[model samples]
Target: MSKNILIVDDSMSLRQVVSIALTGAGYNVIEAGDGNEALTKLNGDKIHLIVSDVNMPGMDGITFVSHVKQDANYKFTPIIMLTTESQQEMIQKGKELGVKAWLVKPFKPEQMLDAVSKLILP
Candidate 1:
């Protein structure tokens, strides 16, 4: 069976780009508009990884990561933050929240895929 990955971002275009890349690479992709939506999607699903944006309307990536780390089901799932923010503080916070990788926005699809491959659960 293919691995499942969640792509959480407010931008529809960004999610489309990510979904295309992952699906083409033989991974099933789940898309959510924000952290709340992502949480809703996680229940009952064996998500292999998460690609999230740092700055979102409802729940930001750092906060979302914290919640995921706290959840018994998804605490071990890897998270990659795909965001426009480059602040060291935010990066540090995300790291503390169990985010495995931090990829800034305007990123190449290949880079994202590489990170996913490195962190995705088997």
Candidate 2:
């Protein structure tokens, strides 16, 4: 079965780009406009990984990650922060919250796919 990957970002274009890449790579993609919507998508489903952006309306990525980590079902699910924010503090905070990888914005789709492959085992 294809692994499910939830992508949370405010930019519809960005989500589309990511979804296309992931889908082309043979993974099922679930999309959300922001962190709040992404949380709703969780719903106990088998999300193998999450790709999130930091600066979004409603709940932000870090806050959303904290919630996910606290949940028993998804605490160990790998997370990749895909955002423009390259601040050390933000990256550190995400690491502390158990985010598996940090990829800055303007990233190549291949880079993201590589990270996803490493985090989401078959």
For 1-122, candidate 2 gives per-residue lDDT tens digits of 99999999999999999998999999999999988999899998899999999999999998999999999999999999999999999899999888999999898989999999999978
Q: Give stretches of model 1 more than 4 Å off.
A: none
Which of the numbered candidates is closest to the native, going by highest TM-score?
2
Q: Give the alpha carbon lDDT tens digit for every residue of 23-120 in model 1.
A: 99899999999989888998977999999998899987777888899899999999999999999998898887778999988898789889998997
TM-score of 1: 0.96
lDDT (CA) for every model shown? 0.90, 0.94
- Could you tell me which residue pairs clash in candidate 1? none
Best-fitting candidate, measured by lDDT?
2
